[model samples]
Target: MRRLAYIRALLLVGLLLAQSRPAAAQTNLIRNPGFEAPYSAWGGIGPIQVAHEWTPWWSEQPDHNPPWYRPEWKPAEAQFFPNRVLSGERAQQWFTFHASHYAGMYQQVFNVVPGVRYQFSVYAQVWSSVEDDPYPSVLPANPRLQIGIDPTGNWNAFSGDIVWSGEAPMNAVIDQWGYMVVEATAQNNVITVFMKTSPDFANKHNDTYWDNANLIVAGQAPPPTNTPAPPTPIPSDTPVPPPTAVPSDTPVPPPTAVPSDTPVPPPTNTPAPATATLPPTATLPPTNTPIPPTETPEPTATEPPPTETPAPTNTATATATVEVILETIEPTEGPTALPAATEVVAADSGGSGAVAEPGEATGNPPAAVEEADSTAASSTILVVLVGGLALVLTVVVLLLVWRRITGAG
Candidate 1:
């Protein structure tokens, strides 16, 4: 019975130890908050807003009229409340939202939540100067225009929820900037934006327009836009430097470019210095790319291994301590309230009805168990020693009798 109990205890201890572990370690991705400065890869017809940390405070759609720059919008455009202009030492535009100008959210990103409804919104008053003169503005005959969204998302429309209204003689108020915000929730998130007009400034030269928008969820701000995972790193076609003394007859292609800081050529007879080869990445090269050395110039120098590479000479080591984030168990909402560390203690103690996570094993001492094991070990030693001594004595006595009998009994 004791042996069976001991075996069961050992098995329980093993099971408890195996069950204690923290979270499986999930990967978390946080959006790059615009606060520290936003970045735009695309914002306009010619990608004008690429350099702009953000769009919206400015215009997203350009005037696509006779010349055909900006295209048709889904929503209608009936007025230009004041206008927007690029300010600051180095920006093309900065939105003003003082007593004079105010309207719309700054920027927007989207999300595909599993089981939640969603919608989008936008509103702004913007204008741009051409060479320092106010562009011409045209007014249509009809005054009462309906503001709703177009099914197609090509242009901004006056459809959906009416943000504001100006029934004629109010002047399409270009100077007095007003505000507008749309609110909607769809069963399925199929977001579409637009700008429609029976006839207004449906012409050209309207540079500073309004198109900053954001999706909203349950009255809360929208989530960040989900971008596809970047591709894996792999070697690609590295632009080679132009070769000097074009082979006898071959035409040398115009200077193709290379990344900056390539290895310098070696002296006529000397070896080249070690150069560094960059890792392949999906990120775009610097705005200004550098050129490589014209020729091999006598195998100047072998490139150095990438900085991220671990050297063979470096000692292999896991000695550096790792910080284990222990998982805290919340108390059960049921009748019983369990302590945060109780699970850890029970798991380590090999107790029942207790669960533990990795790195959360309690260091509670097991003095009684230790002393019991020690006593059992000591008893086993004494039994073996006594048995061996008795056997030795018996052997000696038998040997003596045999000797006597053989001699001459």
Candidate 2:
């Protein structure tokens, strides 16, 4: 009973392990993260909109606030946006590490779930132009770029700013850039990313760049640890089963060594019978020899029978008629030799005594077969011309031999 229980427990553990699912890879939730398009998809502050998907934010306060204020956050084209851009051209440009720039931009992100941890990241840089701000000697105030999430699109319901930095500030140096990443669990479904720069009244040419903003859902936690199984206690009063009661089927004894060795001698002797079996197959060679003789006689047998058939008799009669006509024409047309050969070819093609084809009488025969027959007739005429030239040469040699014998006499 204890063994049966242990077997059942082991099966249950294997079943659970088979049914468990593996964790999936993390996916990004933010759309149009590079801000390479027009600002039609993003909500922007009225006059200070610099780049697409990017809105500038300031620290100014107004009582009649439509939030119509601009802060130090502005757009600056990186090295890749094609234009005769001024020292501070505010347009989306390609970054060395990213596809395009956001340049101080933030937009509302979708599909954020509550209590799920997410990672947000962006590459940001700062640029200063000699034409815009000439005062390099005076150290400028560092710029601030902030990312935040808000449940509501309004500024009042702002969740705490995303903690993308620990002790290091989110400030970018002039012509230097780095990635800023933040990890936090969302409290709501909608995430509104924010980008803000610190107000610098003294520095007019300060430009900040942001690009490749992304939001990725972090990996989920594994299932809770399984509870430990209870320890099995040993029985004290149970009587032990007899060893004789164990199954006799399990312990199969190996065959006796004498029997195994005896079988080896039999196998050596058994090869004689195996070799004896080959003679019956060797006798099959006599059977195969009779087949080739029968097969070789087949071609000679079939060829003579075909020549005796009525089709060959018809063809032979046609060729004999063509030969007599050629001999009669050869006496009159000695020089016009090829033309007589052509006529012979036409006669052999059954020109005068030709039986009408099955389709020709009812106009049902295919035109294609008629064209093929015409091509075959032309090829046969060509072969006859070559034979006629050889006949002419043979006649010329016979006449020369006759003349030489007469002159020798």
Q: Which residue pairs show backbone clashes in model 2?
A: 54-105, 58-71, 359-365
Cα lDDT tens digits, model 2, 1-409, are: 9999999999999989878855554555665555543443123323243455444332222221111122322334446542212223233321111011122345666667777766656555554332333323133334444444443333321233333232114233345444555556676776666544432222323455565566676454322222122122111111122112221322222221121111112222334688998889878877777787867776555554443443533444445555665555444332243333344444455557444532343222344345445655665676577556655665565556555544543
The lDDT values for all models are 0.29, 0.42
Model 1 residue runs over 4 Å out of place are 1-47, 50-68, 71-109, 112-119, 128-173, 189-204, 211-214, 218-409
lDDT of 1 by residue, 322-392 (tens): 11111111221321222333443465566665454444443453543354445555655665555555556
- Whole-model lDDT, candidate 2? 0.42
Residue 292's lDDT in candidate 1: 38
Displacement of residue 345 (Cα, Å) in model 2 is: 99
Best by lDDT: 2
Q: What root-mean-square deviation over C-alphas does model 1 reach?
A: 49.0
- Superposition TM-score, candidate 2 onto the true structure: 0.35
**Once superposed on the true structure, which residue ranges of model 2 sit more than 4 Å away at CA?**
1-25, 40-47, 50-56, 61-105, 128-138, 151-172, 219-409
